[model samples]
Target: MSVKNKVAIAGVGSSRVGKVPDRTGLGLAAEAAKRAVEDAGIGWDEIDGLLTAYSMTEKYFMLGSVMCEYLGVRPKYAASMVVGGATPGVMLNHAAMAIAAGECSTVLIVIGENRKTGQTRDEAVAALTTVGHPNFENPYGPPMPALYGLVAQRHMYEFGTTSEHLASVAVTARYHASLNPEAQMRTPITVDDVLDSKMIAEPLHLLDCCLISDAAGAIIVTSAERARQLTTSPVYLRGISEFHTHEHVSMAGDLTHTGAEVSGRAAYEMAGVVPGDFDMAMLYDCFTIVPLIELEELGFVARGEAGEFFAEGRARLGGQLPVNTHGGMLSHAHAGAAGGLFDIIEASRQLRGECGERQVNGAELAVVHVEGGVLSSHCTLVLSNSR
Candidate 1:
């Protein structure tokens, strides 16, 4: 029997994914959690396993216990996942196998963070290393921008990529975000505006970085048979993969390339599809450089061709493969940079014909990529309109 026993994402739900001072982390989770259950046509008591990312927050709360108290169901399998941003995508894969193995009937996966009202962008980056190793990279006091800047510099040097190309990614994503009212940064910007923006680090401008906002998102997944009985448009889980280059950005394997090179290949091989086969894609855009690097690694373009690839306006709106149509983390807000879930949710919306204006026409197949920890880890997922 295949471990991938034909699982499907029955429902996906998210709370207001922006800076809202009205709710706590648990409150946000509850908002998203209720919508997901309603979307799935299930109840709180139906979920057997409760999977959450970062159960221990700065406030130090237990996710499983908290969720149980809020939802009023003590789960059979309850634990917090700490695999960084890749936790949600990878843990979703784990949830599929668990259901196939008859270990659980229904699974709930959630990622929520309250950074907007709590900490500023600079303040959030400072706390990342408290749980990381301080012996080597942390002591340098290098923030995520510095680590990601290293990759941007290498790409510019290797692929002849320009600062203008990076600015284009920012400019376009913000345009899409303007179409999304739920996005944190809804203002539209131009490439010229991005180029003129203030510099955070060398080759990384203020517009190049994703926004830090407070929000939460959740999804309800069940067995394929159950999904068929529940929803008319049961979006299938085609393939999933995860990879890590290194914990600390300083010791990364390659500056120009990323672990997405490996993880992307794994996703294609497992899903039985090529990069060109995808109708749409959601490349994680924590920084402008991430999607550029991932595009090359995923074979959408050549290794040194991402610059030209992006410059052609091919990845923008009405392009061949319109990417991050819901604005992505660039304009969508990065809740601990796990904002990648919004990408996944948007893709699902496009596939299900929910996104009215930003929807890609006939989006039968799509990809959602989420990353966290400054290029240290990534999760790649392929979703298709049914088998």
Candidate 2:
């Protein structure tokens, strides 16, 4: 019998999201790692490999060296990845492949960034330019919010994607966030308020962009056999795919769309599921326009039809396709790459029905969409809670 390699997420864990204090970067990371290991019913010594999407946020170079020491792990293999939001998802795929190939039996993938304590949201914005292809984009003073606004502008022009529609997204997300105590923007928000909020860039308002907050999240991957013993119910990764548009902002393959199309297609093919199969989706909402475009690319709606996709309440609770039940980056905390890591965590939680007020009803199969680096990189994962 030919055995298929099935990687299972034995644990899903997160640190307190938003404006966390009294904790250093290493302290938060170690707590998350310990929680994940405990959630997996395993010991740190059992981990032979560790993969983290850090360095950019770890900003502290010794993160890996210190994290390992704190976790009581002297792994034979340890490497940090720097793939934006796609970092954790991609590193997970890498760890899964490694486990299946006998490279390692157990691996931990963790990500965290203390933007609040380490740097203010404005400070983070100033540093956003550093993530750019310094030579080409930096000289243009292309602020991250403005860069995303540029995409929003083109999306509206080409696809008839409206500012109101984008406002609907932030409004919807905050509505969900109000149900989540952990969400950063729990205060009641409205589409009218979104429309009236301060404009950051044309077509992009303060509500349209996700908040920058200090946060940490982690996920554990192991072989199917080990997963069976670790948890009563495990969320399995059906498929994983990643793509990068271009190294710089000027090379955005297409402003109206994203490289998510390419990666989304790959993962959907691997998972043998189309848009119709997804009960829920936790799409990366770096900007409101991002998920709007993903709805078109992922076949959730017709191309140029995402404007109307959320129209008539389709993307809301008790609608055709409920989304971002634990709030999203917009209403939740946005911790750089860890933002998407929460997307994955929330997808799993929704699948497990563990989410309190924000839980999606009967979500068995879900998609976690994550993108980073100014819409330059994308990652997609199809996860199922089926045992």
**TM-scores for every candidate against the unseen true structure:** 0.94, 0.95
Question: Which stretches of model 1 miss by more than 4 angstroms?
Answer: 1-5, 55-58, 120-122, 128-133
Worst 10 residues of 2 by lDDT: 1-10
Quote model 2's TM-score: 0.95
Q: What is the C-alpha lDDT of each candidate?
A: 0.79, 0.79
At residue 14, candidate 1 shows an lDDT of 89
lDDT of 1 by residue, 179-247 (tens): 887788887888888889899878999999988777888888888889989899887888888887777
- Give the clashing residue pairs of candidate 1, or none: none
lDDT of 2 at 352: 70
Clashing residue pair totals per candidate (backbone < 3 A): 0, 0
- The CA-based lDDT of model 1 is what? 0.79
